[model samples]
Target chain A: MPENMTHVPYYPGCTLKSKALGYERSAMDCARSLGFEMHEIEKWNCCGASFPLTKDNLMGLTAPTNILIETEQHCKERDIDAKLITLCSFCYNTLKRTDFAFREEPGKLKTLNEFLNREYKGNVTVIHYLEYLRDVIGFDNLSKMVKTDLSHLRVAPYYGCLLLKPQKELGLDDPEEPVILHDFLDALGCQVIDFPGQVDCCGAYLIMRNPDKVLELSHNILEEASEYGAQTIVTACPLCQSNLDQSEAVRGEMPILYFTQLLAVALGLETEQHQFESHCIDPKSLISSCKKFKEFSDAK
Target chain B: MQINTENNQAAIRDLEIATGETISDCYQCGKCTAGCPASMDPSPSLLIHLLKLGLFTKAVNSASIWDCMACLTCSERCPKNVSPAAIIEGLKRIHLNNMEPEINLNSLGQEFLAHSTQQAVVSGFRKFV
Candidate 1:
């Protein structure tokens, strides 16, 4: 994972391209440093999030299937070897899992293919940046590249629900506790907080369908993280980051951030890369709380 | 997940059916209600049960949803998936669509919406996607 690599497919979800633009910038920096190029999935659409269990089940799967087929075809059409990577948590789950399910479930894939053929057509392998870092790139190799150490601050690694629960179905991580986020944080030289509700749901989909549930779920997390002495919360996906940071009930009060925000700090990127002020939660104080560094040279 | 939710502060049948779910089968189980950590105040499970049962009309309109963290802890622990959390979510959806004009939007809500837009543009999952 060096600084110069060939181009690979990238899927920039809504937040990355806009609100989470900071994530996009850090990703670009990381991708380049890791010898990777992000080739965005042009003309991509939603991934059945916000409301996956729509009035029709097949209709729900169609959203993600379209992107998968497009990626699949692109791989075959151009005969390229690289796969698609996502910065969004929900998008990553939908894309990676859809490709996984379709590849493993022939019947479901066939049905999806019929719909895909009518719309988008391509071959693609979907994955979150965290997955590529751990499974393929290796954290040990990743840690070697870090010039800045975040070992002073303790971070509560929040997985939310999509990555964990209904474990037998999603296959994202262990139902009880998932440590991929912590592993990455630990590599960055940060202290990881072992909290009880790390993998719990942040009332993601339920937010739109039920705001009270979202509030209850959110405030609960902030209290727990604060109680556990986690100065800030780091996440790989944007939705959880946004939810943990933006919601009014939990916003302004708790310290939370995206995993990339922390990584950007590690890469020696400017503070703007983390966009602390613009965040709904106003993590400016938390960012400073990450362990005041007069300069990276001071640590040396 | 089941608990003695009876003889509580609120009655289940007194509220409106926001999520369109039936709470009579709830069996006084406080799983969903207990798992919720929305408010620092003691507006616990049984009250949420009553809220779901059409007891608390102002619950959805109030600042409760804004206080909820969207954690699905109760839903996972419920024996019958009584899903007071789900019911609360339904109420929140209704409240958001018709929230008070002076309401202060939380960072999490804004972030979730922005993130949802991104996911939608990427895969056509939610809006226009």
Candidate 2:
């Protein structure tokens, strides 16, 4: 396993390990197929999604700070400073903001390291898998490796906050008009459709406190996608998927899929390897439809 | 000045220092309110207006503070960079610190926990508690 020698340390946050199994499986498989290998850290913990905007709160910083310390140690053992890959957008956002706090603010970093009993600086860089794909793997190369062209599919790319917000440290693209997912989906041979609700908040976590708000937000997104002729909405955040994927209004409107799942399917991985079973709306119909298209195209 | 009014003034002063953003900087532009996705009753601008006037009671009483999704849309579009999202968070902290509302952890498990990630529950506790 030559890839193992240079394996990049991967952090699978709580959601990916439990609820988003397919996201993890498909992301790893797709990364491997693209010539990048992800090695999960032996010890990792959840990065609380909502980063405390309060400057005086040290307790809020503990969880993400400890995860960074562990990741630093993981990279040290491998003698590699490769970036830590995160599969979930919320995790990516939380970790990235915390990491920035450590690097930019010396006073906070000193106090956090002292509390954690580790002499760690901001050594390990945290990046979302989308960044890994776009920056590291190169979308053009990714496009060339497609086994089943997804040209017949129309996908709405939902960024659902976090990936680009606060505009201070975590902004990955033009917050008003991001095209990272647009180019990525197009490269995979899928027609990317433009929708206004693509960047709207999914009323994240409000599904608990305010279910109606979440339903309204999720329904708006699904309705917009359906109106635009999108078959499924692809997203990078597990929270966004959970909120939008299986709501009563969105259940049959359109299937919500992790971008990695789509990549794994396009890379010609067996259906069993991806966890389409966990999805509420059932993406198997969409996958089978693509398979039928592949078979029909191959026959000609 | 009445003792209660003095305390309210102190609270606003402390909040300004804590958030490192002066309410005076807001200038009643309403840009934050216009861009806010969660904008509704007691709009972001309205909350800021009350906060600038040192009306902590009215600001905290409004349910809109809790409704802020922390999407930062207002922050991104704010002409003065006045983060209504951060202000709302500060208001929640003040509420939690004052009211000492019993954040029944059990209440979190009602129905949403089943669908939510552990990260969300943990973060929600960290922010609210």
Candidate 3:
């Protein structure tokens, strides 16, 4: 638990802190296991995700700007150099695109700077934890460091739209179907399946005005998942997990689990610390079959 | 400006608005929810979860909307024919409208520019779809 060992800034967006608590925990453990430390950016606000309801680009730009300023101030105060590691897919996409906007168009960055009245120094690199996991920490190293390998389970790697959508910023894989999740799952020794609904949305934000609609989309993904022979769906995004797991409560029975939940089990982590059952989706039947691997108790 | 919940919800009825039929078929079974991956979120369980909490606003303006693969997995499994994927698409459109054309390394926008690939013959999927 060294606080100064090649520390990076970990930005656990709203979902990570609340709904996706499992993701945050696994991410922290994963980072530490890799011998790295993450200092959270102080008092961060929402990234004006999706959109600000104004239908304007500038408003959208402003959301990330708020975050950028906050991150900059933190960096300045600490006098430490580290790129920002984002846990949420949406957050990663937002920060990466914002940073790219600044770098690609310095003039726009300057205009933005005038609004802030501070010098726009290239302070931090906003990167997705997956990228950090793969690039900053090598795949071979990750494979070697795995205290738990989910070699027995069959998983469908759901990319969801945000992560793989804007292909360029995501740059993780193919536009129609990506392989990053599949690769990560494979690294964990889970038998990854190529499914049809691989790139679909989890009906996340839509849970508000349209429960019926969420049902339709979610049902579609699950039906296809069954067709694909996926016993469980694994996602890196907490929102994705929320839509995939919780959506079933209103609907019926679909087996959806977070990637971290399985990873935690594989890592021999205690169920109480990870709390796999707290998820709206029941992982019982899915992990019940996992008995062949190791002893799993639902203490949480 | 009037919040006509019934009419608005009815308008987007039966998953597909163009159908214009009230999908009176729904029995309120959790079948659709059970089959969905996006339903992994809490709000997806109860349509009310979206409204009661402030989650609805975030959903429409969410990167999560764009995250939908539109595999129709939920639609296919729904006993009531909910088509949560379509609603997600509708919300995603809202996000897309407000979306800044992130010309960064992750944008898939450029993929639509050409109708042709290496040995190719095709327009952007948006046009054909």
Candidate 4:
């Protein structure tokens, strides 16, 4: 399993490249430290977080389908058999659901492909970063690659809404009580805290118009995490991270860290620490105080 | 509260066709309303009830329609498999279609628009438009 990954295909959904650059950087660095190279698709576009739920909304499928088509073509040209891994949960859900639509409704896929004047056989398999860690990379190798054990940090793993929903199909972990993140954190030598708000919505896309409501939801989540005695909240979705971190309600008391940021810390990967400057609730102070930081320093 | 079943028949049919969920099967169990994280006044169950009763106009303008985060928790928790989020999306789409001519792209101020991250603008327009 250790040698399974040499060069892998990565899909940096729009938010990752723009708003969540820290997540993308940390994830790529961590992957390299674990003996893998993450090669992003040469040309990519946004996987509109707003997936068209209606039957006739073919236009809504274009951006995601185009990304899939391009990624598949790249893989084909290179003869690489890698699954397209996504950093954003929103992108993961949209791309995965689009792929599902192509598989389940071949007629729609054919029609869309024809409309775009391109034929995609739906060859690309899309996955979230967490799945890449749990299934593809394997936790044993992950633990072995950790240069600094983070057993002293207590983290609340938030799954948000998209990662696990429409439970019957998505092939994501259990929608009700997913433990994939908890297990991943445990393997990274962190004490994972369980909270009810772990799977609650951060009111995605509502942050603009309904700041009050988004703040209320964010407050509820952070309140639960704080009550559970979690020093920080770790999440997979970029929007979720931004929403939770940017909410003024928390007043900079809680630090929201992307799951990969913690991975970067545990692996002692040298990264630009200023990547955290954009976070509303600063994670630098809490992250620097972790037991791993001491171990990292002693080793240095 | 007025039921305009005769006038809104086409709207109801369009909703059913669009969402692909059986709106009439909801027996008012309130599971969707109960499980929704962002559920507020004019709850998800009430929105579905408006659809079931053929009150498209009321359903379309309901604040709860926008309040729905489209989390799909209600869809998973529904006993009869009624997807409230999908139904809300359909309602929003209907509203958008009715306002299509007036939805001038230039009318959306650039400065006001710039405040939102790409996630919001893309998701907001994708669902509504």
The best candidate by TM-score is 2
* Superior candidate under lDDT, 1 versus 3: 1
Residue by residue across B25-96, what tens digits does model 3's lDDT show? 445565656655554453233442342243444444434443344434555556554555546545544334
What DockQ does candidate 4 score?
0.64
Which of the numbered candidates is closest to the native, going by highest DockQ? 4
Model 3, runs deviating above 4 Å: A1-4, A51-56, A76-79, A250-254, A288-300, B1-129
- Alpha-carbon local distance difference test for all models: 0.61, 0.79, 0.59, 0.81
lDDT of candidate 3 over A1-300, digit per residue (tens): 445567677777666665567677876766676678777888687774542211123445666777777787787787876478887767776777777667776776787778767655666677777777778776666666555546777788887766654454447657565766777777777788888887776565544334466667777777788787777888776666766665566655666766666665655554455556667766766665554233323432
Residue A167, model 2: Cα distance from true site in angstroms: 2.9
Q: TM-scores of the models, in the given order? A: 0.68, 0.93, 0.65, 0.92
Docking class of 3: incorrect
Candidates sorted by DockQ, best first: 4, 2, 1, 3
Candidate order by TM-score, decreasing, is 2, 4, 1, 3
Backbone clash total for model 2 is 0
Give the C-alpha lDDT of model 1: 0.61
The C-alpha local distance difference test score for the whole of candidate 4 amounts to 0.81
Which is superior by lDDT, 1 or 4?
Answer: 4
**lDDT of candidate 4 at residue A217, scale 0 to 100:** 89
* Per-residue accuracy of model 1 over A1-300 as CA lDDT, tens digit each: 555576677877556767778778877777677677787766677565543321123555787777765676656666787488887777776666566555565676677668656533334666678877888778998787676657777888988765554344456567566878888888888889989878766656444445565566667777788889887887766666656665633444665777877776776556665567766667676565454345655765
Residue A97 lDDT (model 4): 89
